[model samples]
Target: MKLYLRFMGIHFRSSMEYKASFFMLGIATMIASLGGLLSLTFLFMRFHTIAGYTFSQVLLCFSTIVMSFALSEVFFRGFDRFEQIIRGGTFDRMLLRPCSLIGQILFEKIEFNRLSKVIEAAVVLAYAIPRSGVIWTADKILVLILMILGGVMMFAGMFLLFAGICFYTLEGLEVLNILTNGSENFGHYPVSVYGKWMLRFYTFIVPLACVQYYPLQYLLGRSDRSWYGLLPLAGFVFTIPCYCFWRIGLKHYKSNGS
Candidate 1:
């Protein structure tokens, strides 16, 4: 962890060299994230509730997913841009180091600009938590923390999957956005609002509802199922397959040989 922190400090100093550009991109990211919030606000103005969920409740869900995605982007961005690293022969250099490949990849880049989205999400969460009418308890608080952690892991797993695909294709796949960015856009509301099939897809296939919908129901006191609070933990299982796939890809990797 100390080494990781050192890497973070180095990355921070490097980013700070271009302070104006850094702040400009951060502000742009924040504004882009706010566009989603504004769309939600306009939709609620037209209808009192969406699928029986109040605006605040929907905002809670939106902010949770956004926060999770922002965390993933900040930490796992190396995986997102793994293709470039491979093409530039950085992967070859990393292999020569004694450090773990995954760790090196994780620390290769730390995008401070993405923190703007995280800050935006935090602001939305601060507003929604109180207005959502949830009677907060220790258990509920723990569940919420787990929900965020699970969401982060799930999205990180998606990024790993994306990286693994790059090993074979030797290029980034734009279509994978359907899982990463697309999921964040669609997740602004509860999965149930999207209809039964969509709900099932998120729950069983992507496991997004495990982190967002099921656990959120328990947090909001909409369900009596105490187990719902722990459903987010199930999302962690997603990382297993992703990691295995990454190993498989590593075996097939053909270095740029620089």
Candidate 2:
């Protein structure tokens, strides 16, 4: 933990050295996030509800997922861009260090700019929470928090999986973006609104719905199942397989020595 904080502080100080670039990137990210929110707003203006979900309800879902994705981007960005580290021979240098590989990768590049999305998500939540008409209780609040945490884990797992794939190919895969960034772009609304098959795929395969859809039903008073609130915990299982794949990839890695 102390090492992690030290790395974070070092990165923070380094980032601050280029304050203009840092703030520019942050503003750009924040604006990009707001574009999605504005699109939703325009759609809601045209039709007040989407698949029977009120605009505010959808906003809640949006805020939750976006917040989670932002958190993952901020913390796990090294994994997301691991191909660069591999190509630059940074991974090999890390292997010679006393620190854990995961720790080194995690702290390699801390993109604080991604916090812009988090701030935008917070603003959306502040606006949507009361208007969504969900009664807040301790359990419900806990469930909401879990939903965000589950989404973060799910996204981090995807980033790890992407990094692992690079070990064999030694190049970034664009198609996997469909699962990472693509999910975030389209996942603002409840998964059920897409289709039964989409919902099933997210639930059983990627477990995106486990964090966003199933538990959201309970949060929105659409379902009375208490178990629904706990479904987000199931999403954590996604990390196990991703981690296993990463280990396998690490074993097979043949460094380019760049």
Candidate 3:
């Protein structure tokens, strides 16, 4: 962990050298993320609620997803653009390092500019907390935080799956936006509102419903037992298939490239 931090510090320093560029991109990203907030605003303006969840409730969900996704994106940016490294022969250099391939991949890119998403989501969370009316308990709040972390891990796994797939095709792909950006689009509202098929996809396929919906059901006092609060932990299973896919892709890379 110390070595990883040191490596990230180096990347951070490199990124800091271009201060103006970083700030500009950060602001641009901030504007785009804030613009996304309006989609939820407009939806609430028309219906006031979805699947029994209020505007603030929806905002809270969005906050968790956007904050966590952006956090991973900022640090794990190498995975986000893994093809660039593969194409540039950087992977060969990485293989020579004593560090783990995954750790080196994580250290290769640190987009400090994406920190704006964290700030923006925090602002939304601050505004939504009081308005949502959930009596904030320590355990409940802890569970809520875990849900955010789980969301980050799940998305990071998706980014890794996307990165690993690049090893096979040797380039970035866009259809993955369905799981990454596409989930961000759907996560702003209650998954329950999306009908049966969407609910099943979120539940069994992507596990978005596990992280956001079932656990949220307990948080809002709509649930009788507190056990539902921990259900988001189930979302971690999504990472298994993602990692398996990554391993298969890695083997394919070695076979075809050499």
Error of model 2, residue 171, in angstroms: 0.6
How would you encode candidate 2's per-residue C-alpha lDDT over 126-174 as one tens digit per residue?
9998999999999999999999999999999999999999999999999
Encode model 3's per-residue lDDT on 1-258: one tens digit a residue: 998888878878887899999889999999998777987788789988788889999888889888888888887788988988888888878878887888888988888888988999999999988888799989888988988888888888889899888988888898888998888778877688899999898888888887888778888988897777887786577778888988888877752342
lDDT of 1: 0.93
Off by over 4 Å in 1: none
- In order of appearance, the predictions have TM-scores of 0.98, 0.98, 0.94
RMSD of each: 1.0, 0.9, 1.8
Q: How close is candidate 1 to the true structure, as a TM-score?
A: 0.98
How many residue pairs clash (N, CA or C atoms closer than 3 angstroms) in each of the candidate models, in the order given?
A: 0, 0, 0
The lDDT values for all models are 0.93, 0.92, 0.84
lDDT of 1 by residue, 129-216 (tens): 9999999888888998898889999999999999999999888999999999988999899999999999999998898999999998
On the 0 to 100 scale, the lDDT of residue 175 in model 2 is 91
